[model samples]
Target: MNRSSARRPWHQHFETVGSITAIVVGVAALFVSFDQSRVMREEIRASIWPALQVDGFASLENGTLAIGLSVQNAGVGPALVERVTIRHDDSPVEDLDALRALMPPGADLSRTSLTGRVVAAGASVRPFELRYPAEESDDAIDVLNRLLSRWSAEVCYCSTLGQCWVASDDPGAPTMVDSCEGQPGGDF
Candidate 1:
Protein backbone atom coordinates (compact mmCIF):
# COMPACT_ATOMS: atom_id res chain seq x y z
CA MET A 1 0.00 0.00 0.00
CA ASN A 2 1.13 3.52 -0.71
CA ARG A 3 1.83 5.77 2.29
CA SER A 4 -0.13 8.65 0.70
CA SER A 5 -3.31 6.56 0.57
CA ALA A 6 -3.60 6.48 4.41
CA ARG A 7 -5.71 9.14 6.08
CA ARG A 8 -4.16 11.87 8.20
CA PRO A 9 -4.86 10.74 11.79
CA TRP A 10 -4.07 14.18 13.35
CA HIS A 11 -6.44 16.02 10.93
CA GLN A 12 -9.29 13.55 11.56
CA HIS A 13 -8.92 13.88 15.38
CA PHE A 14 -8.93 17.71 15.13
CA GLU A 15 -12.20 17.72 13.09
CA THR A 16 -13.96 15.42 15.62
CA VAL A 17 -12.90 17.49 18.62
CA GLY A 18 -13.99 20.75 16.94
CA SER A 19 -17.47 19.37 16.13
CA ILE A 20 -18.02 18.16 19.74
CA THR A 21 -16.95 21.49 21.21
CA ALA A 22 -19.32 23.40 18.92
CA ILE A 23 -22.28 21.18 19.90
CA VAL A 24 -21.61 21.67 23.66
CA VAL A 25 -21.41 25.44 23.31
CA GLY A 26 -24.67 25.60 21.34
CA VAL A 27 -26.57 23.54 23.95
CA ALA A 28 -25.24 25.68 26.80
CA ALA A 29 -26.34 28.86 25.05
CA LEU A 30 -29.86 27.51 24.56
CA PHE A 31 -30.24 26.63 28.24
CA VAL A 32 -28.93 30.03 29.30
CA SER A 33 -31.44 31.84 27.06
CA PHE A 34 -34.34 29.82 28.51
CA ASP A 35 -33.29 30.64 32.07
CA GLN A 36 -33.05 34.34 31.25
CA SER A 37 -36.49 34.35 29.64
CA ARG A 38 -38.07 32.75 32.72
CA VAL A 39 -36.48 35.33 35.01
CA MET A 40 -37.76 38.17 32.83
CA ARG A 41 -41.31 36.83 32.89
CA GLU A 42 -41.29 36.57 36.68
CA GLU A 43 -40.07 40.14 36.99
CA ILE A 44 -42.79 41.39 34.68
CA ARG A 45 -45.48 39.72 36.72
CA ALA A 46 -44.14 41.23 39.93
CA SER A 47 -44.13 44.77 38.52
CA ILE A 48 -47.87 44.64 37.88
CA TRP A 49 -49.13 43.06 41.09
CA PRO A 50 -52.24 44.65 42.62
CA ALA A 51 -53.24 45.32 46.24
CA LEU A 52 -56.52 46.79 47.50
CA GLN A 53 -57.30 48.33 50.90
CA VAL A 54 -60.73 49.18 52.27
CA ASP A 55 -61.03 52.01 54.76
CA GLY A 56 -64.70 51.67 55.65
CA PHE A 57 -64.74 54.71 57.86
CA ALA A 58 -66.38 57.78 56.34
CA SER A 59 -64.20 60.84 55.81
CA LEU A 60 -64.15 64.17 53.95
CA GLU A 61 -61.52 65.12 51.39
CA ASN A 62 -59.69 68.46 51.33
CA GLY A 63 -61.87 71.27 49.94
CA THR A 64 -64.69 68.76 49.42
CA LEU A 65 -68.27 69.25 50.65
CA ALA A 66 -69.23 65.56 50.96
CA ILE A 67 -67.95 62.60 52.97
CA GLY A 68 -67.75 59.01 51.81
CA LEU A 69 -66.00 55.75 52.57
CA SER A 70 -62.79 55.01 50.68
CA VAL A 71 -61.03 52.15 48.94
CA GLN A 72 -57.38 52.51 47.99
CA ASN A 73 -55.16 50.60 45.64
CA ALA A 74 -51.77 50.62 47.29
CA GLY A 75 -49.91 48.45 44.84
CA VAL A 76 -47.63 49.01 41.85
CA GLY A 77 -50.42 48.58 39.33
CA PRO A 78 -54.03 49.71 38.92
CA ALA A 79 -56.69 47.56 40.63
CA LEU A 80 -60.02 46.56 39.14
CA VAL A 81 -62.66 46.15 41.79
CA GLU A 82 -64.85 43.10 41.23
CA ARG A 83 -67.06 43.30 44.28
CA VAL A 84 -67.28 45.26 47.51
CA THR A 85 -69.09 43.44 50.32
CA ILE A 86 -69.32 45.24 53.62
CA ARG A 87 -70.36 43.80 56.97
CA HIS A 88 -71.05 45.41 60.27
CA ASP A 89 -70.87 42.97 63.22
CA ASP A 90 -71.07 40.08 60.73
CA SER A 91 -74.28 41.48 59.22
CA PRO A 92 -74.20 42.44 55.55
CA VAL A 93 -74.27 46.19 55.07
CA GLU A 94 -76.44 46.95 52.04
CA ASP A 95 -77.38 50.58 52.64
CA LEU A 96 -76.49 53.72 54.53
CA ASP A 97 -78.59 52.73 57.54
CA ALA A 98 -76.69 49.49 57.95
CA LEU A 99 -73.43 51.42 57.65
CA ARG A 100 -74.56 54.00 60.19
CA ALA A 101 -75.50 51.28 62.62
CA LEU A 102 -72.01 49.92 62.30
CA MET A 103 -70.44 53.30 63.00
CA PRO A 104 -69.31 54.73 66.33
CA PRO A 105 -72.81 54.33 67.82
CA GLY A 106 -73.58 57.99 66.99
CA ALA A 107 -73.19 58.50 63.22
CA ASP A 108 -76.12 59.90 61.21
CA LEU A 109 -75.03 59.04 57.66
CA SER A 110 -78.02 60.97 56.26
CA ARG A 111 -75.86 63.12 53.94
CA THR A 112 -73.82 60.14 52.74
CA SER A 113 -72.91 59.89 49.06
CA LEU A 114 -70.66 57.48 47.16
CA THR A 115 -68.09 59.77 45.54
CA GLY A 116 -66.16 57.25 43.46
CA ARG A 117 -65.92 53.51 42.96
CA VAL A 118 -62.86 52.79 40.84
CA VAL A 119 -59.64 52.77 42.85
CA ALA A 120 -56.39 53.56 41.10
CA ALA A 121 -52.90 52.74 42.24
CA GLY A 122 -51.94 54.79 45.26
CA ALA A 123 -55.26 56.59 44.95
CA SER A 124 -58.50 56.63 46.97
CA VAL A 125 -62.19 56.97 46.10
CA ARG A 126 -63.52 60.53 46.35
CA PRO A 127 -65.23 61.63 49.57
CA PHE A 128 -69.00 62.08 49.75
CA GLU A 129 -71.11 63.66 52.50
CA LEU A 130 -71.49 61.31 55.50
CA ARG A 131 -73.46 62.47 58.52
CA TYR A 132 -73.06 61.30 62.06
CA PRO A 133 -75.60 61.06 64.88
CA ALA A 134 -76.13 64.27 66.85
CA GLU A 135 -73.81 63.12 69.63
CA GLU A 136 -71.51 65.54 71.45
CA SER A 137 -68.35 64.79 69.48
CA ASP A 138 -65.19 66.90 69.58
CA ASP A 139 -64.54 66.98 65.83
CA ALA A 140 -64.90 65.03 62.56
CA ILE A 141 -61.38 63.57 62.80
CA ASP A 142 -62.11 62.08 66.20
CA VAL A 143 -65.29 60.50 64.87
CA LEU A 144 -63.50 59.10 61.85
CA ASN A 145 -60.77 57.58 63.97
CA ARG A 146 -63.30 55.96 66.22
CA LEU A 147 -65.24 54.61 63.28
CA LEU A 148 -62.08 53.26 61.61
CA SER A 149 -61.07 51.44 64.75
CA ARG A 150 -64.29 49.48 64.45
CA TRP A 151 -64.93 49.01 60.76
CA SER A 152 -65.45 45.86 58.69
CA ALA A 153 -65.37 45.51 54.92
CA GLU A 154 -64.22 43.05 52.25
CA VAL A 155 -63.13 44.05 48.74
CA CYS A 156 -62.28 41.82 45.81
CA TYR A 157 -59.86 43.28 43.25
CA CYS A 158 -57.82 42.14 40.28
CA SER A 159 -54.85 43.22 38.17
CA THR A 160 -54.39 43.60 34.42
CA LEU A 161 -53.07 40.06 34.30
CA GLY A 162 -56.37 38.75 35.68
CA GLN A 163 -54.81 37.87 39.05
CA CYS A 164 -57.23 38.52 41.90
CA TRP A 165 -57.49 38.60 45.70
CA VAL A 166 -59.76 39.57 48.59
CA ALA A 167 -58.52 42.13 51.12
CA SER A 168 -59.75 44.30 53.98
CA ASP A 169 -58.76 46.15 57.13
CA ASP A 170 -60.75 43.86 59.34
CA PRO A 171 -58.67 41.43 61.43
CA GLY A 172 -58.36 37.95 59.93
CA ALA A 173 -59.64 39.20 56.58
CA PRO A 174 -60.18 36.46 54.02
CA THR A 175 -58.64 36.57 50.54
CA MET A 176 -60.38 35.34 47.40
CA VAL A 177 -57.12 33.69 46.19
CA ASP A 178 -57.99 33.13 42.55
CA SER A 179 -55.34 32.93 39.85
CA CYS A 180 -53.07 34.93 42.10
CA GLU A 181 -50.24 32.61 42.98
CA GLY A 182 -47.50 34.31 44.98
CA GLN A 183 -48.96 37.76 44.30
CA PRO A 184 -47.05 40.75 45.60
CA GLY A 185 -49.17 41.57 48.65
CA GLY A 186 -52.14 40.74 50.84
CA ASP A 187 -54.11 43.14 53.15
CA PHE A 188 -53.17 46.74 52.56
Candidate 2:
Protein backbone atom coordinates (compact mmCIF):
# COMPACT_ATOMS: atom_id res chain seq x y z
CA MET A 1 0.00 0.00 0.00
CA ASN A 2 1.03 3.68 -0.49
CA ARG A 3 2.14 5.85 2.49
CA SER A 4 -1.23 7.71 2.72
CA SER A 5 -3.22 4.44 2.71
CA ALA A 6 -0.99 2.98 5.44
CA ARG A 7 -1.64 6.05 7.69
CA ARG A 8 -5.41 5.53 7.21
CA PRO A 9 -5.25 2.11 8.95
CA TRP A 10 -3.48 3.67 12.00
CA HIS A 11 -6.24 6.30 12.28
CA GLN A 12 -8.93 3.62 12.22
CA HIS A 13 -7.08 1.65 14.85
CA PHE A 14 -6.97 4.72 17.13
CA GLU A 15 -10.72 5.29 16.71
CA THR A 16 -11.53 1.66 17.62
CA VAL A 17 -9.36 1.79 20.74
CA GLY A 18 -11.04 5.02 21.88
CA SER A 19 -14.54 3.51 21.55
CA ILE A 20 -13.67 0.43 23.56
CA THR A 21 -12.10 2.49 26.32
CA ALA A 22 -15.23 4.68 26.59
CA ILE A 23 -17.50 1.64 26.85
CA VAL A 24 -15.39 0.05 29.55
CA VAL A 25 -15.34 3.23 31.61
CA GLY A 26 -19.11 3.66 31.31
CA VAL A 27 -19.81 0.10 32.41
CA ALA A 28 -17.45 0.40 35.33
CA ALA A 29 -19.16 3.60 36.50
CA LEU A 30 -22.58 1.95 36.37
CA PHE A 31 -21.39 -0.93 38.50
CA VAL A 32 -19.85 1.44 41.02
CA SER A 33 -23.14 3.32 41.41
CA PHE A 34 -25.05 0.10 41.89
CA ASP A 35 -22.65 -1.06 44.59
CA GLN A 36 -22.83 2.25 46.45
CA SER A 37 -26.63 2.14 46.49
CA ARG A 38 -26.56 -1.32 47.99
CA VAL A 39 -24.23 -0.15 50.76
CA MET A 40 -26.49 2.79 51.61
CA ARG A 41 -29.54 0.54 51.87
CA GLU A 42 -27.73 -1.76 54.25
CA GLU A 43 -26.66 1.19 56.38
CA ILE A 44 -30.25 2.36 56.61
CA ARG A 45 -31.39 -1.14 57.53
CA ALA A 46 -29.04 -1.18 60.50
CA SER A 47 -29.98 2.33 61.62
CA ILE A 48 -31.33 2.57 65.16
CA TRP A 49 -34.48 4.51 66.06
CA PRO A 50 -34.27 6.91 68.96
CA ALA A 51 -37.11 6.65 71.45
CA LEU A 52 -38.96 9.94 71.54
CA GLN A 53 -41.82 9.53 74.00
CA VAL A 54 -43.07 7.13 76.66
CA ASP A 55 -46.28 8.19 78.37
CA GLY A 56 -48.26 7.01 81.42
CA PHE A 57 -45.76 5.84 84.00
CA ALA A 58 -47.85 6.53 87.08
CA SER A 59 -49.38 3.11 87.61
CA LEU A 60 -48.11 -0.46 87.43
CA GLU A 61 -50.78 -3.16 87.09
CA ASN A 62 -49.54 -6.43 88.61
CA GLY A 63 -45.93 -5.89 87.49
CA THR A 64 -47.22 -4.73 84.11
CA LEU A 65 -45.94 -1.29 83.20
CA ALA A 66 -48.17 0.22 80.54
CA ILE A 67 -46.56 3.07 78.66
CA GLY A 68 -47.33 4.63 75.30
CA LEU A 69 -44.33 5.22 73.07
CA SER A 70 -43.51 6.75 69.68
CA VAL A 71 -40.82 5.41 67.34
CA GLN A 72 -39.63 6.63 63.96
CA ASN A 73 -38.96 4.12 61.17
CA ALA A 74 -36.17 5.69 59.11
CA GLY A 75 -35.74 2.75 56.77
CA VAL A 76 -36.97 2.65 53.17
CA GLY A 77 -39.75 0.19 54.06
CA PRO A 78 -41.86 -0.82 57.04
CA ALA A 79 -40.17 -2.17 60.18
CA LEU A 80 -41.73 -5.40 61.43
CA VAL A 81 -40.81 -7.15 64.66
CA GLU A 82 -42.26 -9.96 66.78
CA ARG A 83 -40.18 -9.42 69.92
CA VAL A 84 -39.69 -5.88 71.10
CA THR A 85 -36.56 -4.93 73.03
CA ILE A 86 -37.05 -3.47 76.49
CA ARG A 87 -33.93 -1.76 77.62
CA HIS A 88 -33.32 -1.28 81.30
CA ASP A 89 -32.22 2.31 81.76
CA ASP A 90 -30.96 2.23 78.16
CA SER A 91 -29.26 -1.14 78.43
CA PRO A 92 -30.42 -4.04 76.24
CA VAL A 93 -32.26 -6.58 78.37
CA GLU A 94 -33.15 -8.97 75.58
CA ASP A 95 -30.76 -11.06 73.55
CA LEU A 96 -30.93 -9.68 70.02
CA ASP A 97 -30.06 -12.97 68.32
CA ALA A 98 -32.55 -15.04 70.28
CA LEU A 99 -35.31 -12.51 69.76
CA ARG A 100 -34.67 -12.36 66.03
CA ALA A 101 -34.61 -16.12 65.64
CA LEU A 102 -37.94 -16.58 67.47
CA MET A 103 -39.61 -13.79 65.60
CA PRO A 104 -41.97 -15.02 62.90
CA PRO A 105 -41.72 -13.20 59.64
CA GLY A 106 -44.21 -10.29 59.69
CA ALA A 107 -45.05 -10.90 63.31
CA ASP A 108 -45.30 -7.51 65.01
CA LEU A 109 -45.42 -8.16 68.72
CA SER A 110 -43.33 -10.42 70.89
CA ARG A 111 -44.89 -13.27 72.88
CA THR A 112 -42.18 -12.98 75.50
CA SER A 113 -41.66 -10.21 78.07
CA LEU A 114 -42.32 -6.64 77.00
CA THR A 115 -39.44 -5.58 74.81
CA GLY A 116 -40.19 -4.38 71.29
CA ARG A 117 -43.67 -3.88 69.86
CA VAL A 118 -44.63 -3.64 66.21
CA VAL A 119 -44.50 -0.17 64.76
CA ALA A 120 -46.89 0.12 61.81
CA ALA A 121 -45.63 0.56 58.26
CA GLY A 122 -44.04 4.01 57.80
CA ALA A 123 -45.50 4.94 61.17
CA SER A 124 -44.00 7.64 63.37
CA VAL A 125 -45.70 6.71 66.68
CA ARG A 126 -46.15 3.07 67.69
CA PRO A 127 -48.39 2.46 70.70
CA PHE A 128 -47.96 -0.76 72.71
CA GLU A 129 -48.15 -2.06 76.26
CA LEU A 130 -44.96 -2.77 78.20
CA ARG A 131 -44.80 -4.72 81.46
CA TYR A 132 -41.92 -4.94 83.92
CA PRO A 133 -41.60 -6.30 87.43
CA ALA A 134 -43.37 -4.18 90.03
CA GLU A 135 -40.33 -4.60 92.20
CA GLU A 136 -38.59 -2.71 89.43
CA SER A 137 -39.82 0.45 91.20
CA ASP A 138 -42.46 3.13 90.62
CA ASP A 139 -39.53 5.42 89.99
CA ALA A 140 -40.11 4.71 86.30
CA ILE A 141 -40.20 8.43 85.63
CA ASP A 142 -36.74 8.94 87.13
CA VAL A 143 -35.37 6.01 85.19
CA LEU A 144 -36.97 7.16 81.98
CA ASN A 145 -35.77 10.73 82.37
CA ARG A 146 -32.30 9.57 83.12
CA LEU A 147 -32.39 7.46 80.00
CA LEU A 148 -33.82 10.32 77.98
CA SER A 149 -31.43 12.88 79.40
CA ARG A 150 -28.52 10.97 77.94
CA TRP A 151 -30.23 11.41 74.57
CA SER A 152 -29.11 8.05 73.14
CA ALA A 153 -32.21 5.86 73.28
CA GLU A 154 -32.47 3.64 70.22
CA VAL A 155 -34.90 1.03 68.92
CA CYS A 156 -33.75 -1.80 66.67
CA TYR A 157 -36.33 -3.00 64.13
CA CYS A 158 -36.23 -5.86 61.68
CA SER A 159 -36.26 -4.51 58.15
CA THR A 160 -36.35 -6.41 54.86
CA LEU A 161 -32.67 -5.63 54.47
CA GLY A 162 -31.51 -5.71 58.11
CA GLN A 163 -31.50 -3.70 61.33
CA CYS A 164 -31.23 0.09 60.94
CA TRP A 165 -30.34 2.82 63.51
CA VAL A 166 -32.01 6.21 64.18
CA ALA A 167 -31.76 8.78 66.93
CA SER A 168 -33.22 12.01 68.39
CA ASP A 169 -32.33 14.56 71.08
CA ASP A 170 -35.49 14.27 73.16
CA PRO A 171 -36.99 10.91 74.04
CA GLY A 172 -40.44 12.52 74.20
CA ALA A 173 -40.04 13.65 70.59
CA PRO A 174 -40.06 11.84 67.27
CA THR A 175 -36.78 10.64 65.76
CA MET A 176 -35.08 12.69 63.11
CA VAL A 177 -31.93 12.48 61.02
CA ASP A 178 -28.79 12.93 63.08
CA SER A 179 -27.04 15.40 60.85
CA CYS A 180 -23.66 14.05 59.80
CA GLU A 181 -21.67 16.88 61.39
CA GLY A 182 -23.68 17.13 64.62
CA GLN A 183 -23.87 13.71 66.29
CA PRO A 184 -20.88 11.47 66.88
CA GLY A 185 -22.61 8.08 67.12
CA GLY A 186 -25.77 8.81 65.17
CA ASP A 187 -25.50 7.18 61.76
CA PHE A 188 -24.44 3.63 60.91
Best by lDDT: 1
Model 2 residue 34 CA deviation (Å) reads 5.5
TM-score of 1: 0.62
lDDT of candidate 1 over 77-133, digit per residue (tens) = 877766655554555666555555444454334442222244667887632235543
Minimum summed lDDT over a 10-residue window in model 1 is located at 179-188
- Summed backbone clashes in each candidate are 11, 20
Give the per-residue lDDT digits (tens) of candidate 2, residues 72-184: 55444555432333343354434434333332233233222222445544556543323444456557676456545432334434444443334333344333332222222
Best by TM-score: 1
**Candidate 2, residue 110: how far the Cα is off, in Å:** 13
Score candidate 1 by lDDT.
0.59
TM-scores of all predicted structures: 0.62, 0.36
